[model samples]
Target: MIIHKSNNVTVFQSAVFQLNTTVVATEDLILVVDPGYLPYEIEQIRIYVDKIKDDRPIYLFFTHSDFDHIVGYGAFPDAKTIASEQFVTNNLKGSQLQAAINYDDEFYIVRPYQLEYPRIDFMIKEDGEQFQVGKTLFNFHYAFGHNHDGLIVTVESENLAIVGDYLSDIEFPFVYFSFEQYGRTLKTLKSIFEKNSERTLITSHGTVTSDQSQITKRISDSYEYLEFVKIQGSGEQFEQFMEEKKYIFSTIFRKRHQDNIMVYERECEHS
Candidate 1:
């Protein structure tokens, strides 16, 4: 269902994981970001796009190569796909992504669409690559750490930032990649927020906020959590931190947090 809509942008939230699918409509073309999840969800996005697209080109942009984010890639065959160069390279590996899809398929007990990786038509080679679609301009920045191929996209006209899988209110830093890289990425987000104070920040899994104070608080919270993990805090400290944040405190996230601690320790030892 539609979560938020303005004059030019519309955001749809999926039932699973609260994953966001954003559509930015312009006079010349329509931009779809991270269209995803179950079959019916993708169908709903397609229907909405069809209604407003009307001969305009549709550009599909994936923030990263996560399975849930790319599950709906096949739904829009005609869309010109865009992603970071790293994301393109990761998708070319095939086996890694295929295994993830297979796992999801088995777990969900459903296969609504033929599971295939995205075919990238446009690759973002640099941090601030700009793409012009008629009067609208989209600037892409490399956002690693959460994942090697992650990206943060800024729509100039809308003053909106679409961040994938980062700055989530419900989740702490997952640190699938390098912990140091994640720290650097958060710094980059801080800089982005500082420069674009008026921009509305949108995350893949949480609420959208235009409040500068809220953005600042989220950045600080994430940085502090990273520090806590880096120092290899005690289990009691971890428990206290979890309670303070009121995180879901589930076994799954707890295990993930523990795994992050192990990875951080190993990396520290190597360094």
Candidate 2:
């Protein structure tokens, strides 16, 4: 479906091909975010980049260290791959990267999505630190909670934010709370929403939201879901109950739970 392009920047997102892929072009460089699942999807992005950006030195950015977000990176060897310092430090090991070569285990499972470990450069981006590629300027901010160092990039000129798994339509497979830290991060994202209430948000999955109200609603609902799990059921029971919701979130939730039921137990203990 090539999920429809969102307004604001010269950004184009691919259809649901594992992890959603986004390409943001300026006058010169072509920056692609999360190169989907397969080589073919990356190839599609390559073709598009060639046609539009003249195949200029590509800048590939990873939102986190997850395999789905980087399965196809080897396809673009010449591109400069950038990621958060935390993700780069933890995931750059051959063992860590290869452990995810197949969806066999949790914490390090790499699905058979055409795996690749690209050369990564670490750039610790925080609020207001701008990443400039050609004419486009993307400012980074913390959208943690989903990942220890998750990032949300805002295209300054266009007023668009490229938020990765930070805001998933997929109900959190399990609550991810680092005690009060996760709570603070969620609050930070809410504040970002309130400040940029009129800007458009390009989520890692599903539809692009033009209204902050939608972001607010989704975050609130996800938190509610987490609370529901904490109060209503044990980790296993919450897993079964959430399956009943039947939204697209259910699929990811089920898969995650199937992979790591203990993660939920840990989260419950923390809460």
In model 1, the runs with Cα more than 4 Å from the true position are 91-96, 107-112
lDDT of 2 by residue, 129-221 (tens): 777766777777765555565677776666667777755565452334342444555676677777878767677766677766678877786
Q: Which stretches of candidate 2 lie over 4 Å from their true place?
A: 6-18, 91-96, 103-115, 125-128, 173-181, 232-252, 255-261, 264-271
The per-prediction CA RMSD against the true structure, in angstroms, equals: 1.8, 4.6
Clashes of each: 0, 3
lDDT of 1: 0.86
On residues 103-182, what C-alpha lDDT tens digit does candidate 1 reach at each position? 67677736556778888999999998998877889888888888789999999889999989888887888887778888
List lDDT for all candidates, in order: 0.86, 0.62
TM-score, every prediction: 0.94, 0.78
Quote the positional error of residue 32 for candidate 2 in Å. Answer: 0.7
